[model samples]
Target: MPQTPHIAFIGAGNMAQAIIKGMLAAGYPPNKICASGRTQAKLDQLTADTGIHTSIDNLSLCDQADVIVLGVKPHMMGDLVKSIAPAIDPSKHLIVSVAAGILAGSIDSWLGQTTPIVRCMPNTPSLVGKGAAGLFATTGVSSAQKHTASTIMQSVGLALWVETEAHIDAVTAVSGSGPAYYFLMMEAMIAGAEELGLSNDVAQQLVLQTAVGAAQMAQESQQTPAQLRLAVTSPKGTTEQAIDTFNKGDFSQLCSQAMAAAHHRSKELANLYKA
Candidate 1:
């Protein structure tokens, strides 16, 4: 890898933009970054905003990039890889994919060779630089390439590696789809607050702050989440009543079922790429 590798993003959507912002903030030279997209307007917008090279030509961009980020949707991945496969040098370039459920083997197959492929699942929170991402790389990826991939991901937020490609599906269930679950809970809380006569604005602010504070506390505290919950739940107190209600309704089981469904769906989506 070059001292400062040239990284190109294949799609200029929200995730790609977030990564670019993080990379720039981390002192990655804008000249070494390039992005390609289908829309000329969006390409122009990205170039104007970040001062990075942007174009609609995906195949040509691959030749100038040492690390190529496949930020396009999962359904478009196969065709996109095949389209640029001829331009990519498998021995020199590293492919990092943020598209969910697509496997490294499938990407290699599409590329027509054993290219160094890193599969990443990053959540919506990446937009705010508080995201959690899970990554899995093929055997062809070198330690230095892995470091480059890690640097890009860690720029936005937490980046962890899974032992197997199958674990990427679990990450999708937990962290990838996890934000929506939190949003649902927040929505219920806000609705309940409004039902109890609080104004919409007040209820939303209260719930959002509570969510943020609780998460901060959980991160700062040395105790486990259950321990922290117990610490707050006094004997026969309001918190205890709420806990009892959740337990009686089998909330934990419900959470498990929901995550299981997400995991199943993730696996199902990957099957779309199977021949």
Candidate 2:
């Protein structure tokens, strides 16, 4: 394993906090981490939660840490990168951006062409150490640097490395926005259950636990999801009824449509950033 470089997050918001907690869970000492944002109250809470240093000065944070994570919003990304560019030493420091719409090229353009940049799209489940991250490294980033980025991301959940940055939009569609898709499914299930005369809590318990158990089964068993779905659906039973309804409603098309919409939006955001 490569040396775990000192890590610093430029924003101490919810996403940054999730990463911080995940890092700690992965055995990074509080002393090895630092976080900075404009809000001192948030920073103070971060310092209290983890022994990592906290600051409102991005430049100072940049100067000290070996791996800098840009956890700010996309709109503020350009300014943050520009301010920390001078503090960044390309040879020793690696920049990992978690801002959704900012690209690796943009980070390099704002800092310097040679800046080792990695773009990561992380989801909300990170707070619970179950996020799926989409990661891609720019041309100059080393193999060691790429693994380091993977390690940082996988500390939360799963991290996938795409062959090209273009595929990240697809990633943004699938796993990046996947949690919300599941949430919406749960909402619909709950509502349907309520309509069927089950108490809200009981209905949610059935659907939610089924979701969890199904995921766990897929993870633990050698069987595929299709096999598992078949295993659950009995001949002309309730499960089959539900499956028939879903098929008739073209649930697969709905999924495709939703993913396409998200992908299109991601492209638009990237275009906006370039503008």
Candidate 3:
């Protein structure tokens, strides 16, 4: 196995901390993982929790890191990259950004023309070590660098690469914003159950377990989702009635529209940080 690179996170917020914890759990050495934050309090918390090095000096962290993860906010990314550009070694350092709406071109401009940049969109589920992330790499990145970046993201969950940066927006709409969509659906299901006389606790348990089991089955089954759905639907059964009501409400179209809106917003946000 290839030796794991030293991973440094520029932001020590929840997402950064989640990845750091995941890396440690995945057997990356504690000494090889470090994070920098703007606040002493957050840095202290990270150190106390992970036993990894933490600091308020971003530039210093970059100097020692083999793979640097930019976990800062979209608005702050430009300035942060610029500030640490001097410490970045294009030949040795790999840059991975988890900030939304920040494109690889803009990041390369802020850092260096030859900087190996990988743009990633990882969702909130990463906190629980079950995230789904989409990555897009710039021309400057080598295959080794790509693998390193993938390993870091996979430490928390699934990491997939997109052929073009444009597809990252579609990913942002799907897995990036997907958890909230499921949460909303579960909320409605639980509320409907309560209205239909199920106790609150019972409804919550049923809906939560159903979601878990459904996802597990979908993953384990050889059949596609459509095939699985057809298998579940019997002739004029109770499931069929619920499906009919959803179809009448144009559920599929509604979901498509929602994802399209998210894709559009992602583009708009990226434009805001154009170089």
Candidate achieving the largest TM-score? 1
**TM-scores of the models, in the given order?**
0.98, 0.96, 0.97
Candidate 2 differs from the real structure by a C-alpha RMSD in angstroms, to one decimal, of 1.5
How many steric overlaps are in each model, in order? 0, 0, 0
lDDT of 3: 0.92
Residues 144-250 of candidate 1 have per-residue lDDT tens digits of 99999999999899999998899999999999999999999999999999999999999999999999999999999999999999999999999999999999999
Q: Which portions of model 2 show Cα errors greater than 4 Å?
A: none
Q: Residues 1-275, candidate 3: write the lDDT tens digits.
A: 13778888999889999998998899888999999998898789789988999999988898888899999999999999899989989888889999999988898899776788899999999999999999999888888889888888999999999999999999999999999999999999999999999999999999999999999999999999989998999989998999999999999999999999999999999999877
At residue 180, give the lDDT of candidate 1. 100
Give the 10-residue window scoring lowest on summed lDDT in candidate 3: 1-10
- Cα shift from native, residue 219, model 1 (Å): 0.7
Single out the weakest 10-residue window by summed lDDT for candidate 1: 266-275
Q: Name the lDDT value of residue 152 in candidate 1.
A: 92
Better of 1 and 2 by TM-score: 1
